[model samples]
Target: MGKSEAQTLLEKADKKANSSGGWFSSSTTKYEEAGDMYQQAGNAFKIDKLFKEAGDAFAREAECREKCKEVNEAANAWWNASKAYKRGYPDLAVQALSQTITALTRAGRFRQAADREKEIAQIHLQETNDLRKACESFERAADWYAQEDATATANACFKDAADLHADLEEYAIAIERYEQVADHSLTSNLTKYSVKDYWLKAGLCALALDVVTAKRNMGKYASQDVTFPSTREAKFINALVEACETGDVEAFTGAVVEFDQVTKLDNWKTNMLLKIKRGIQTESIL
Candidate 1:
């Protein structure tokens, strides 16, 4: 049987990789060169639209680099495999990214792992539009950042996950994350002033759940942040909560209008509040 083109390329790559005193030799330079050959073969396979073959070649390159203790290079190779897989096989791409994250984390590259996690989140968000997967990826990134003591980045990732959950109407999760952001903010003098805003957002998420839950959450937040002063945002949230508790549609509309006249709700907030109002109206009809 004739050797196929891909098989021939793989054989050549293997030959080059094993040339320097075997695959486990301590010669970083030789392994790097071998990795380059494998990468070239992978790229060729990718151009030929043989995604699985390309992914396999890139995985081999990553393994070679890992054996050489070139952790960063190995991670990059894995990431490249992910990109190649992304073109035709999203599930494979996700698997490749997971491998890259594991490699990076094993190398104690927390920041890089976090970055890769963010990429996974983007893949989930943009490619698959899988909100649950996207949220989980972002949460994983936040966890990695927290491991590295990157508080600001971690908090940002948490906020991103929270917003995605809120968009999916996972209000309970959103509330938890919003409170986390607020708590983290309060821990830093520079961000302390912004805590109230997050708390308000959390309160809004709670309000989306039920009036009783919202009231309980409001009390919890108030107790958590004793320094949280009276603000228009707080007032608006309180009014909304009260209206919801009473199931007073007219009062809810009035409160929203009054708040808008004073501070003007953004489109997202307006939409969210409108949804709550619509729910109240529907309940009244029922």
Candidate 2:
């Protein structure tokens, strides 16, 4: 009902946690008691609506559990600490969540660890606007997810990483990520239909480099997916490549317009296409 009640619980917790028992009580028993005391204090703080104190209490409990080698329990405590701190202390929340991820990884809970990594990435993206940190977390999560055979989720993370890399103008890294996802997508029947989209994105990133690189990548993509060579997307890419090689800006514009007539290009695709168009024009001027 009040802070006084929670404060009383905290005092009792401190008393219990600090006491040294006789020979009958071992160090393990003492530490476990300390952990239980800390947990009770955390819950009491929560009941009194003292969120930061509650989070601090849970973090203490997590530390105690970690010393006792109760890894999973420590991970759970760390997660609780993160959740309690998320709104008011976002940086602390990310740190606590990072601890949770590390603990879960130590427990060999790869999927759970990957999930927490994604949460950290989202926190960076939505709460902090730290694009570089977000990209790194997503990339790490994707690798872990792939190791756990979560192909779909891994691809989603990879795509997010790729998008961020492209936004940062790291085109070579973006191309690698897009192609990696496409290569994996081709192995799953459910995802095979989406490989074309991934390859198209990879091709766009390559186009940012040069027409020769784009043509080489197109050939590689076609070899991986036989039907890819016959698709309208492939033809459209080919037309753009020829336009770039010959320095024909009108042909490039016509190719984009023709493709957009039947299939709507989203803002990203449209922007990338325009960027490549500009590169070709600059080359022609030289």
Candidate 3:
């Protein structure tokens, strides 16, 4: 064979020799020959120290090293740390995660090592129940990923912060996050149970009933509801029981007005009105 073709064959053989243990055996250390080849390559590249070439060689060597006990410990340590963080142990989790990051760095996954560092910070801020700090960390994470134009990852962090804030009953913050979710227009992609849509409809039904029954702050309620009323709004009906019992003058006039307003928004007015009459009759019995 020609010199270049012979060299290509050697490289392929070198690659094949180094990749041992089929990826499933943690204790299988039978790839010493492959590991030696990797070490030779790394040393050869180290002489030049061209950053790209060194990095590539390091990656290949790291991959060539079988699933040694140290690598397993590193992965396990990180996994346990993640579990601990989830269970509310920030200090311990960060310590373990730090070790994992070190191990991964040594394994030549520099970027992943950096990501784990950020993850450690996030756990301390969020999983430790520090919402403010968590928000900061999440923003940092979003910024880091955004700088790389990783919109999906950035949004995921934002979404996590939003959910965390919501869990803490920070509705305003939650609303902001919800707005971010809307910004992605994920609704177009989602075809699941649609709990949000259901809740929106329920909210509209409740608001309409509140206005027709009490009439206090009805205009503001109407205005707000008008802008963002739900799809199931026309399918919902208010029984108007309290209004009937109290002989609310507001209900008598306001009910028809709101009903007309709701009807104008949809063609399902008759179905809604019938449902309301049925609801009223049910209330009459109770």
TM-score-sorted candidate list, best first = 2, 1, 3
Off by over 4 Å in 1: 1-33, 41-57, 67-70, 83-90, 223-229, 257-271
Top candidate, metric lDDT: 2
lDDT of each residue in 117-169, candidate 3, tens digit only: 56765775656756666665566666556666666677667666665554444
Give all candidates' CA lDDT scores.
0.85, 0.87, 0.48
Task: Write candidate 1's Cα lDDT for 34-109 as tens digits.
Answer: 7888898898887778888899899889988997888888899999999888886788889889989988888889
The residue-by-residue lDDT of candidate 2 on 1-286, one tens digit each, is 6557667766776776678766798766776887888888888888878889888888988988897899999999999888888867879889999999989999999999999899999999899999999999999999999999898899899999998888777889999999988888888898888888887877888888887789999999988888999988889888888888899999999999999999999988988888888898888889
Instruction: Name the lDDT value of residue 112 in candidate 3.
Output: 60
Candidate 1's clash total is 0
Output the number of the TM-score-best candidate.
2
Clashing pairs in 1: none
Alpha carbon lDDT at 216, candidate 2: 92
Alpha-carbon RMSD, each predicted model: 4.5, 2.9, 15.9
Q: Which 10-residue span in candidate 3 carries the lowest summed lDDT? A: 230-239
